[model samples]
Target: MNGHQIGEKVAVKVGTDMDEYSKPVELEGILKSKGDLLGYLNATNDKVGEVCTLSIGNLDVIIANRGDSFITINHFTRAGVEIEDYDVIVVKQGYLFDELSAISKLDILAMTPGSTYQRIENIDYKNIPRPIFPMELA
Candidate 1:
């Protein structure tokens, strides 16, 4: 199966051809914070540069580096609400630019109704257990 389908379940090839399955998951959360977009102007900060942080459910995901035409969803695991990169199983899909235009234009300020950036450092996914398919920290 292709990675784009919203609820499609598929087996993802992990390191050294070990197969692990993950479903295409989507959560409607807010754009919590947007880092300095200009940081990407220099090639040196390419992949490490973060463009936006999305609050999906109780999880905060960092969408790094702007100027790309698609949004990549990756499989991941949480260690007490902290997201660990090794858990990322696959790039579910690359959302097309036009398709995400409206979402991209979202009012980021709305995410921080009262608090500041320092107060909202990470997504609270602690309730979710590790090594489970289709489940994130609660």
Candidate 2:
């Protein structure tokens, strides 16, 4: 329980796989990824209009759209969802934090442990034979 209520509705910008969008295909006379059938029915399982369930804390967030360019804040506004309506919005892109901060009062930067972006000084590199640069000073 990370302090989130059971039925809280918060906006979030989460990461999803884009492998299907990168595949080669043709649709409506134009050659593009098969996922381009955004407004069309009976498309792939991950079509734009499709919805997915994302469980965060104790709450379940419904992802209404999936596309290549939805990471931008403008997309959310265009989709009729106001950013200020939610208590917390979790975004994965670090660059987006700057833009979202203009609307929200507080912004936090959190990185997963053991990820590539984690602090190098905190890692115990037992295999390395030589001392590294700033890691040694830290």
Candidate 3:
């Protein structure tokens, strides 16, 4: 921790409570968290080997390992951390929060393959109008 280089080690800073995730000891990858955020930090550490997680009370937690460095903060509005300090910071949120957006030099939306219910569909209506949108605009 004292003498480690970035990228040379895996450093993850999680901003949510681990208890909510229910980290399984033998498995890897996130099983919950509403399909958002990388919920596998706990078990995923096993694959990396010797991954260290530092929990700063309930507000945050960090996982650090040797060889590769990456952060996983559950909260997008983490102003406590000077994101500019890191070479590459990955905030797994759809859009950057105001706090992070201010200092972010290059923010991007990295969408993974999953059921994105960004829109509602495939539902049966007992009794409703066929068309919901107005044909003409006023």
> How many clashes in each structure?
3, 0, 4
lDDT by residue for model 1 over 1-138, one digit each (tens)? 122332333222212222222223444455554443322123333343334445555555544432332222211111112233223322223222332333343412223311122233343445745744434333
lDDT of 2 by residue, 1-138 (tens): 123333344344543333342343321111111112133222332335533334455433434445333344554444444556678876543334334567767767676432233555655577775557665543
For residue 136, model 1's alpha carbon misses the true position, in angstroms, by 37
What C-alpha lDDT, on a 0 to 100 scale, does residue 38 get in candidate 1?
29
lDDT of 3 by residue, 70-101 (tens): 33432211213433445666644346555556
Which candidate, 1 or 2, has the higher lDDT?
Answer: 2
Regarding TM-score, does 1 or 3 come out ahead? 3
Query: Which residue segments of model 2 deviate by more than 4 Å?
Result: 1-71, 78-80, 113-138
Q: Model 1 misses residue 90 by how many Å? A: 16
| Clashing residue pairs, backbone N/CA/C < 3 A, model 3 | 8-67, 9-68, 9-69, 10-68
Each prediction's TM-score versus the true structure: 0.22, 0.37, 0.30
| Model 3, CA-based lDDT | 0.36
Q: What are the runs in model 3 whose C-alpha is more than 4 Å off?
A: 1-82, 114-138
Between candidates 1 and 2, the TM-score winner: 2
Worst 10 residues of 2 by lDDT: 26-35
So what's the TM-score on candidate 2? 0.37
